[model samples]
Target chain A: MELQEKLKILADSAKYDASCSSSGSNRKSGSGVGNTAIAGICHSFASDGRCISLLKILLTNCCIFDCKYCLNRKSNNIKRAIFTPEEICTLTLNFYRRNYIEGLFLSSGIIKNPDYTMELLIKTIFLLRNKYHFNGYIHAKAIPGASPKLLKKLGLLVDRLSANIELPTENGLKLLAPNKESKNVSQIMEYVKINQSKKYVPAGQSTQMIIGATKETDLQIMSKSANLYNQYHLKRVFYSAYVPINKDNLLPSLEHPPLIRENRLYQADWLLRYYNFKVTDLLDVKNPNFNILIDPKADWALRHLEEFPKEINTCSYNELLKIPGIGVKSARRIISSRRNFTIHLEDLKRMGVVLKRAKYFILCNGKYITNKEFFNKKFIERNVMLEERSLIPTNKEQLRLF
Target chain B: MNNIYIYDGDFISLLNIILYLLKNNLHPENIKTDVYHPSLFENTIYLSILKNEKIIDQIISAFGQYAMRSMYYVFLSKEENKELILYYFFQNALKRRHKIMYYHNLKCVSEVLRISNYVRHETHKMKGFLRFKELEKNILYAEMEPTNNILFLVSCHFVNRLKNEFWVIKDNKRKIISIYDKKQFVIVKEEEFKLSQKESKGEQNIEFLWRIFYKTIGIKERRNERCRMNFMPKKYWKYITEVKEEL
Candidate 1:
């Protein structure tokens, strides 16, 4: 096949792997060439409205394993093509110079077994770094069941590495992608974590969990994601809402991707990462799923009404962050502005706080309250639900899944 | 009297203007910079004796080098009354003992930051969107029309990335060329120099492949033009070759 034809097929197949970030690590060129930006840059957005940061493609679409949820399953009749190392290097360099991408995102479909695919990906990058002297940001996906020595060598060359937790639960992995096992994925993640340093996977490890693939609750998924963070020391746990590309009896056929639920999980994930909230704080046995009507923060605040009416002027930084609309930026602004002058509710808006939800939860001064009835759970929930109606996408289709 | 100081629109000149006004203990309202606009009153006096060495060192030590860079970007802002705003920012910044970076809630401080953030954001976007095509001379050539005069900032990133290659980044709006000849880059105007490009066969093939990849990667089930435009603005769609099909 022509290189262009191969590129089209491989890229189309690789679109299912949705971790497209090219961030975190800053690789220096040392007067050589190509450095990674401290904050990643988005070169373009695909028609799907996803950021095209990396040259995400597959080595080949030919597979030996029959994974029911995948487009490149062995049972599926699809066009397959494998890229030569030289072809990949040429494409990445041209794309980098033209500023088409940050670097390469190379994955495969069990091309001649796991080690062979991993070696091809590593060899392509080694040539890219040593001979071509291309020092751009690279993010490579690890093939499961690959040797530890190969994983170490692979980690040494790339800026960021990922071994996707394709399914949220091990049972989901078994039911859907029977040829694949969750243990192999974790093994690679563990290896990457141990070997990671400035020289190896400097951006650290990140993994993706397919949401709504099998019958997994938001609680189960989040608990799995939180455990991955604590155990693997992950940089990010990307949540990909399962896009029903296959019509198998095993997979749940959906007309639209579960966008609303996916969005709620991300909000809960953010609170887990930044808001210093434990998994238990966000989700309980009674509330197994996030409240789609209101945000996780607002939901938490409404349940714990004693924590409401946090004084904006004298509240601690962490205390202010607990409020629904007050983010890290606005929280810091409140802290600095309070030191100089008496901050009123009017000043809080200018400081970048979203007052729609925060007004119900905070007190600007000791005396002035936004609404006395804000203390009522029913009233607060009604207002938040109204706000969420405006927050929904203009059209029902979501721009991003992760 | 409104004492207007007419100096070159450089960072050092802004510092000189600030220091001159400070030494005279003049209020910020009385001091006006001639760089932006001229006042239509006879009471305005222009002072131009700006070859001072001691003032630069003193200002550097007092404001710190980082704050001086902030002033430079604030000066580049197209916002009206930037001089008066920056004047207030500097006065407040100095009074706070160089804790200006943290004064996010201050109106003047945030105003300076808002402009700098624009400069920073534009530079960051161009870093990823900059496309270099190899011509007949084997020189990598690219063109853009940025909202801000950010050629110096954007080229600094490219110099480190493509140090060994000969390349030129042309700012079509500002009509300036930042040309890098393998080692270092020099900014030249249209009067000084110009480079003509001839499309290479190899370049077309590579772009054809890239366009193919760009088209194939998009999942048709999720097409949100508004979200795409939010990140890769439509204004940039014309220059990005892969996005021309989108046009």
Candidate 2:
């Protein structure tokens, strides 16, 4: 097969992995071809609105295991291709030189077995680093059930490493991917966690969980993510909405991918990581799923109405973060700006705060931006929903506005 | 006298004029660049451009390092009345000392912060969206048309990242180009240097493969052109290799 044909096949299969970030490690290119930016750079955006930061491709699409939710399952009749170690190195080096990609994100289907697949991945990455003298960012997938020695070596070479927890619950894994086990995924995470040091996976490890796959609630997904953060010291937990690809009874059949749910999960995940909010604070058993209308943060603010009208000028950093529109930067700006001058409501927009959502929650110098009647829970919820109404998919056929 | 001070559009010259006026306590009606339009009643004073090495240090010591950075970024901006904005920003920053940056509520301070943020945002976007095409003898060339004068800022990042390769980044809006010779880079105003893109062999094939990879990587079900345009604006599509006519 031609190299272009193989690239299209492998890249198409690898698109489902969903972790495209090339951040968290600052590798210098001293007398080398390229270097890694600490903050990461997205070379381009794909049609699906995902950032194309890395040369994301599979080493091969030929699989040994048959996972029902996956498009690359063994039973599926699709064009299969495998790239040689030399081909991957040349492609990554050429692409890097052209400023087309930040680095390579190499994952593979189970070519023969776990060990065999991992060795091919390691060989490609090693050739890219040593043979090609490419010192840019590399994110490699840690194949489940791979040996500890190989996993450790892979971690040492790459900037970031991830082993995906494909489903939020083990029950989902058993139902959809009967051949796979969550234990193998955790084993890879545990190995990387134990062996991780300054040089070994300096960007730390991350994992992904497929949302809306097998009846797992947002609460369960977030709870699992929180557990992963506490247990694995992961950098990011990516949430990919389940796009129905196969004609199987095991997977949830959907016309459109549950993108809204996936977006809500990400908002909640950010709350967990940055906003210092617990899973319980955002969701409970009663409210298992996120309100498809408002974001998780605004939803939390509405449920706790007693916290409304916090004085923005005198509020602490943590208090400012709890308000609907104030983000980390805007919150910091508010605290710093208020030191020099009193922050009126109009000044919040200039400081990067989204006043549309924050105005319902905060006050300036003990005076509400709107009347006190607008502070009621129902009114705030209606307004917030209206603000986010554009994001909601209008219908099955209509195109969305930019 | 309603004197309008005009200095060559250089950061140091702007600083010198501001300092000269402040030292003599001559509050000019406005401070503009050489590109200013004369009003009906105007007394325009053209000041010669000279590098004042101590002015930068003075500003740093008086208002702090952050103030100096904001002032420089505001100077690089393409905003209207940028000179007067910088003058007001520097004056307020000096009075408020190091704590001036925190005064986002103040009009002068906020204007400086906003324009600097705009420049920084463009610099970041250019770092990602700028695509390089391989020329003869392994030289990479790229072109951009950013609103702000961000050629120097973006070149600094590429100098360290692509240190072992020869590359040229041209800012078409400002008619400036950054040339890096595998070790260091220099930014110069070049209006007449023709860009001869002698393509290396197999470069087209590599770009074709990239376009294929970009087309195939996106999930078909989640094809949102709006979202893609939001991140990578439509204005940048002219130079991006992957965003072809079909996409």
Runs in model 1 deviating more than 4 A are A367-369, A394-402, B1-4, B27-44, B52-60, B64-66
* Model 1 docking tier (incorrect/acceptable/medium/high): medium
lDDT of 2 by residue, B1-247 (tens): 5789988877788899998777777788888877888787998998664678788888889988988998888888889788888777777776889898888777898899899999988888888989899998888999988888888899998998788888999987878899998778888878645567899898899999999999999998999888988999988878899885654
Best-performing candidate as measured by lDDT:
2
Per-candidate TM-scores read 0.94, 0.97
DockQ of candidates 1 onward, in order?
0.65, 0.84
lDDT of 1 by residue, B123-234 (tens): 8888878788888767888899888888898889888877778888898887899989877999989567766778766899888888898888888866767778888887
Clashing pairs in 2: none
Q: After superposition, how far is residue A308 of candidate 2 from its true place, in Å?
A: 1.7
Give lDDT for model 1.
0.81
| Alpha-carbon DockQ of candidate 1 | 0.65
- Output the number of the TM-score-best candidate: 2
* Most DockQ-accurate candidate: 2
As for candidate 2, its interface RMSD to one decimal place is 0.9
